[model samples]
Target chain A: AQTVTQSQPEMSVQEAETVTLSCTYDTSESDYYLFWYKQPPSRQMILVIRQEAYKQQNATENRFSVNFQKAAKSFSLKISDSQLGDAAMYFCAYRSGIGGSNFGNEKLTFGTGTRLTIIP
Target chain B: EPEVTQTPSHQVTQMGQEVILRCVPISNHLYFYWYRQILGQKVEFLVSFYNNEISEKSEIFDDQFSVERPDGSNFTLKIRSTKLEDSAMYFCASKGGAGRNQPQHFGDGTRLSIL
Candidate 1:
């Protein structure tokens, strides 16, 4: 079984600054996918960015980027130029790859979320 | 962009009563899933449906829980007998075909309150 861990329960960043949220996972499988989801007060789960385990280069989406260290089993999210809209609960999620035992059924395993607050 | 939509943004039901949450996934999506998150907790996967049958389920998904895609576009999750502990935000998600690196798209969850 794969387990995701977000050590920080709460984080705050000043407006226009950068913030990094840490996440680690334990998985025996070699191929997998990692994702970051944001949940605002509206409670909608919005995709922030994703990283493929096989890719050595990190994934970047505008202001949101990921630092994926496969050997260390760590995937972290970095938000640059943070804005008030970035204030939300962020979750790190994991999913098995195509060849894994649970191939056809790729359900996501999520970590305890970290509530991000943007200070003006 | 295509999106998954769930109905009755909020539901309140008595314990021991049946409750059904409905969702309309993206028109082209082939995989459907149900997940729940207790207040202040992480989102947990419940079940995944493909080809009109359940392909995977979690320990949390017991006999009391059921999923069905009764029609062409609607997917539903039913709780035969709800319990207080079942109160949580139920989310519906869908994804494209297998072997692709597509991310699962989620809907705005339905808050289920069991009294």
Candidate 2:
């Protein structure tokens, strides 16, 4: 079984500033994927970015990036030049990479979530 | 960009009644999945469908729950007997490409309210 933990229940950042949301996971599998999702007021879950365990290089998508420390089981999300639109509920999720089973494919274990507030 | 779409947007049902949530995955997608999130809880996987059959399901997907791809485009999840605890936001997702590396795209989700 795998579990994702988002220690920060809430985070706030001033407009145009930067913010980091922390996440950790416990997984015995060596190969897996980590993801960050954003749920705006519309409640639609949107993929922010993803990182593969095998890749030592952190993933970056525009303003969203991740600090992935595989040895520490930590994958934190960083939002640079944060905007008001970044205000939303953020979730950290883990998915196994073992093939031939749905457990490794479609199923994802998600953290409770971190509410991000962007202050003007 | 292609995206998954769900129907009804919201559903209200009485306890013990039947409720069906529908989704239309991306046209080229080879995998389908169902997940639910209680108001204040983490999202949980319910089931995954491929090749016209269920590939895997979670413990939460008991006998009372069923999934179907009745047509070329429609994927549906039916709860035989709705309970108050079944009230949540049900999301439908689709994954393309090969293996488990592909990122799954999620729909807007249907809010199921069981009274």
Candidate 3:
């Protein structure tokens, strides 16, 4: 069984600043993927960024990036130049590689979520 | 860009009533999935469907939850009996059927409100 944990229940960042949301996961599998998803007030789940366990270098998407430390089992999301629109709940998820099984490969185990707030 | 679409942006139903949430996956997608997010909570995986059969489902998707691909385009989630706990935003997702990110495309979601 795999589990993800986001210790921060809530975090606030000033407009145009940066904030890093922490995440930790437990999985015995070697090949896997990590993802950060953001859900706004509209309740729409949006993919922020993703990182593969095999890739030592973290993943970056525009202003969103991930600090993935495979050995430490830690994957954190960093949002730079945060805007008001970034205010939402952010989740950390994990998925196994392909050829596994249905709930096998792509099934995502999500963390509790961190409510991100951007203050102007 | 091709994306998933879900119907009934918002649904109001009473407890014990049956409700079906509809989704139209991308034309080329072969993998479909259903997830839900309760108010102020993380998104939870409900079920996954592929090759016209249920590939996987979570413990939360018990007897009350069912999924069907009635046709080439529509994938639906039917709840036998709605409950207050069932109130949440139901999301439909699809992927290209290959790759690592497999980047699941998500629909805006159908807000299910059980009264």
How well is each residue in B1-115 modelled by candidate 3, as lDDT tens digits? 7778899999999999999999999999988889998977878999888888888889999999999999889999999999999999999998876666687878999999999
lDDT (Cα, 0-100) at B112 in candidate 1: 99
- True-vs-predicted CA distance for residue A25, candidate 1, Å: 0.4
User: DockQ ranking from best to worst?
Assistant: 1, 2, 3
lDDT of each: 0.94, 0.92, 0.89
Give a tens-digit lDDT track for model 1, residues A55-115: 9999999999999999999999999999999999999999988645456569999999999
Task: Looking at model 2, give its docking quality level.
Answer: medium
Name the lDDT value of residue A65 in candidate 3.
Answer: 88
What class would a CAPRI assessor give candidate 3's docking?
Answer: medium
List residue ranges in candidate 1 displaced over 4 A. A99-104
Instruction: Give the clashing pairs for model 1.
Output: none
Task: Determine which window of 10 residues in candidate 3 chain B has minimal summed lDDT.
Answer: B96-105
- What fraction of correct interface contacts does each candidate retain? 0.66, 0.64, 0.48
Residue B20 CA displacement from its true place in model 3, Å:
0.5
Error of 2 at B14 (Å): 0.9
Worst 10 residues of 2 chain B by lDDT: B93-102
TM-score of 2: 0.97
- After superposition on all C-alphas, the RMSD of every candidate to the true structure, in Å, is 1.0, 1.2, 1.6
Q: What is the lDDT of residue A85 in candidate 1?
A: 99
